[model samples]
Target: MKCKTIVGLFLMSTLAVFSQNASVVSPNKKISVELRNSANTQVGGWYLKVNYSNDGKISEVFQQITLGLDRADQSFSTALKYLKTSKPNLINEHYSVVHGKRVQCTNSANEVVVSFENQGKSKLNLIIRAYNDGVAFRYEFPEKGGTFVVNDELTTYCVADSTKRWLEKFNPANEGLYTSSKDGNLQQDWGYPALFNTPDKGCWYLIHEADLDKNYCGTKLSNVAEKSKYKLTFPDQWNGRGQGEVKPTITLPWKSPWRVVIIGSLSDIVESTLVDDVSTPSIISKTDWIKPGIASWNYWSSNHGTKDFKKVCEFADLAASMGWPYTLLDWEWDTMGNGGKLEDALKYIHSLGLKPLMWYNSGGNHTWVSSTPKDRMLTHENRVEEFTKLKKLGVAGVKIDFFESEKQSMIQYYLDILEDAAKFDMMVYFHGCLVPRGWARTYPHLMTYEGVRGAEWYNNGPEFTTTAPEHNTILPFTRNVVGAMDYTPVTFTNSQFPHITSYGHELALSVVFESGIQHMADRPEGYQDLPDAAKTFLKEVPNAWDNTKLLDGYPGKDVIIARSKGNAWYIGGISAERFPKNKTLSFNFLPENVKYKLTLISDGEHDKKLVTEYMVVEKSSVVKVRLLGRGGFVACLKPIL
Candidate 1:
């Protein structure tokens, strides 16, 4: 009788361990996510299986999505009861932004909220959304106003070992190059917006997070447990100058940020607005003052140019000559010499009808210990005082630098500055910062983030001379897909160090990189010496676009893209290989039966020069272009009117 009783209890417990499962699919039925709550699995207590449909052929892209919640009070990771799933609902909305890859965007997804109860009876909700482009999910604690301590989040993603990935090593500032590998080896930390490609399945995936706010700490991926599995890892003790805790302490009734997996072809990865789709909409009501345009920056040419009043005016003159609307007065404007003060430079800039942007150090012991103009933007009172004075002086924007941390406090600091800046109608740019994760959508006044090893690195080291070409090709697929990246591109002349990329490659960056304020990094002399056609193209490049499309190429080898502003289209392409590449530019994306004039600027026989040609073409025309090793090209298409 005793043995029979023990056997009955064991059977009941086994059944309870793997109780319920649910699935959700995209509205188009192309992507699906399946959740299995099995307490016995090594993937925490819950795991997800994701599949994608290509031409009616289904393939599994993700094997497991480990999920759990550890709190100081209780563990939501084990022995959870599945309650019920809400009916799938469609969310389709359209919105416009101040500046981005495109002016307008659409957010459409099919969503379902799955409910659960932990052994301690604490309720948790898992909300999943499936879009044609990707899948996103997040956790929610619906309980009322009480405090909770999140010891850790046990969310990990597992994929097949054969998949190729371009992952950047984890850093607080997110300023590292992406390493492409497929050796089944893992790193202790990998940054977000990690790109993966499954050649056999004909699909691409980019993993990132969205809707991140002050309530939580930023996270990255760590596959130290298993090479193919990457779990969510918080910031290390060294980050934020070791000032803040790695764990997040939050108030109740809070939903964690969405873990977004962008899935599709390379085009889908490039053109998808899935990151913006999952983030919060614009919180600022008045966005008319926020404008996107090219800016004449002196830092690339003379890092301390602001100290010389003549140098400041030269850049302002460059902006005026190029028909750009703004000139950036880089750091040290506070100590201006050689015939002008801060007010004097502002007056001169405005006299030329150019808006002036000033730079500031983020002002903390956390980073950039030696930079000046520090501590002016660290608090609300300081920002209000500074911004009020700037607004009174007609300063258009503020470029705050050196925030080298991803802790919850730093994240809140970024938000606080944005919110405060908006009140005074000032646009903001962040340098020495974390990669953008959809904050541009939430804060329209936020212009750009310099979280890349961009042109400025040319001044710092010689390694960029060789690695930059490959890095530039990969960014369109990885970093820039999330938000505006301030690469400070288009330098025709050398900085302290010379770039090995060709003149045509330099010209193409003005189009290839998307930034709210595209900083033309060359000196005035460089622009004056450019061919008439190339200079004209520089003047016509638009910072904001109406539409964008990825035409061809791969991650590290080459890339071609076409972007439209109004009725005109701009095409940019670059090659990263040591050997030359030949590509055919098919205008099939153009309106059928329409004639257009194409102005093509391509690499010359030599790397230092550029060659320009003009031709009349239609939607059916296929123009061939040759990119020299480490070279590029750009073209403009306007309907023959």
Candidate 2:
């Protein structure tokens, strides 16, 4: 009976191992997770291991094969065998150690370390943050980093297939993975899941997909000089992706351990978890140097000619008179197909008090400019030269248009432009681009990017009648969390336009949306004809703010945001579809014992006209308010002594 029981137990254990789809291979020693696609194909995998002291303290956690390699070579086959071997020597040279307590491992080439701490519940909190334009990850440690408590790593590994194609086609090199086939059987390269590694205490290593071309890759090390903070080092020969016509695959397989360190008690880990749920990336800088201002001509007005220069100047003069700092000399002014001269137009724009920003294409291809002069077009090598010319032309910034979509190569191309622009003190605003993922902080010169379905669409038709109202409310929670949005606000009034939401809602958007360089999206004639009180509010409204506070409302219903600059606060409130007749707003964050003079813009109580009312109020324990129907409100408050 005892012999039979032993045989039965062994059989049960084998089944248990097979059933575990994703789990820690060995608690406190190794951690791993496997992922399958919707088609049930094993597409990706992740693994982590830790070595620790006898007193329940971690010495190191080795990352063997966090993200599996593509089926490209014999080296990958050998790495798979090494993973199963679980032998100490099979582990790669990349391993991270924290003092003598804990260690981590990975094979990634680029790494960023933000902050880490310990939470008392036998868990250590590890935050693997990013300084570039990518996502971040967090890990939980058990018993002073003795055991790695992993949740799910599969979500982080899956790269959108479309993003890979975007990278290849838009990359300046023009090398990619996709091939045209009507039958849809094309040879495409799959993106590898990103990996992190720390061999010793020198620096953190990050390994990720270089671009759309999966053949070539590189790694970057962070925080090499210091033990506590981040310093970066790059490989001497490690040229990034798309460097060669026929991309060369790395000969060596990644077989290293990714590591993170914790200095304090377990309580630090618990505290870090509070922010773990706030998963979206945050902006590092607000693009203050770019100066939040207004632009004159937009996509619709780009066709206006030299004959209309006087009219354009009149608009620019009005924008400046209304306290706007900059105006745009959009397309057609370039003399691309026409005989217009850029140098001549720039001279006239500078004569006005407003700064001039011109439009350019990423690939130097515009609708009208069938054949661009070789010198004007942007190539990788000559990008610096073109930027220098624009700077010499006395342009404050350049609007790079028609990126089309979010592709890996296009994304990298944008980053390259931003890096170059910084060298010349030039600012960039991207059009037809993807949502921001905190790149503005790394490169402060990246003024703005257009990913939102903004005011420009209003010109296409009345499609906004179906979605615009809800889109405004949903974006703040989703896109705004990532970074600043260039949602061009304040379009012409509904009375004149007679399109989507009310004119009051448009006025409210000026306050609701956040942009370093905000656009007064309507024609100057739209607001110029309104009463002095309405015109004064638009003229005095500032685009940038020191701080922002969310007062009330949800995704699609309503939202109130208060922005502050010095002693003044600007409150903007918006409601979708219909305005609340008797909305009561609470001001709990206002300073106590201070009196404020408020300038309010709201819909008239009896008349249908939108009016600006002035009132005085004190910041007490709680302040109350009311709102009009389809009506929005904007109030400027000055603190009185």
- Please tell me which predicted candidate would have the highest lDDT against the true structure: 1
The reply for model 1, stretches above 4 Å from the true place, is 1-21, 39-44, 199-201
Look at candidate 1 and tell me the lDDT of residue 591: 97
Candidate 1 lowest-lDDT run of ten: 14-23
Which predicted model would earn the best TM-score?
1
**lDDT tens readout by residue for model 1, 1-641:** 99999998998775554333367888888999888856544233777778888998776778889888888888877666777778888999999887888778989988888888887778888998989999999999998888878998999888787889999988877889989987448556888889998747578899999999999988899988888888898888788788777788889999999999999889999998888888999998878899989999999989999999999999999999999999998889988999988899999999999999989999877884767888999899999999999999999999999887888888899999999999999999999898888899999888999998899989988888889999999999999998899999999889988888888888999888999998998999989899999999999999888988999979999999999998999999999998888999999999988899999999999888889999999988999999999999999999998
lDDT of each: 0.89, 0.45
The local lDDT score (0 to 100) that residue 52 gets in candidate 1 is 87
Q: Candidate 2's residue-wise lDDT over 1-641, tens digit each?
A: 99999998987775454324222222222222221123222221233222223244332323232322222221111122111211112211233211100113232212222111212112122223212112233332222212111211221221112211111112212111211112212222211111222233212112232112121212222222332222112122212222222222322221111222211121211111111112212122333355555565544333353235555566577677787887766655545223335665567677776777766655532122232232243565677888788788788888776554233334456767777777677777876554454455445466666666676666655666556766676454433433456777776544212345555566778767766566676666777776676678778776656556667655556677777766888877776645455556555557888878887777555323567767777655344445554456777888877
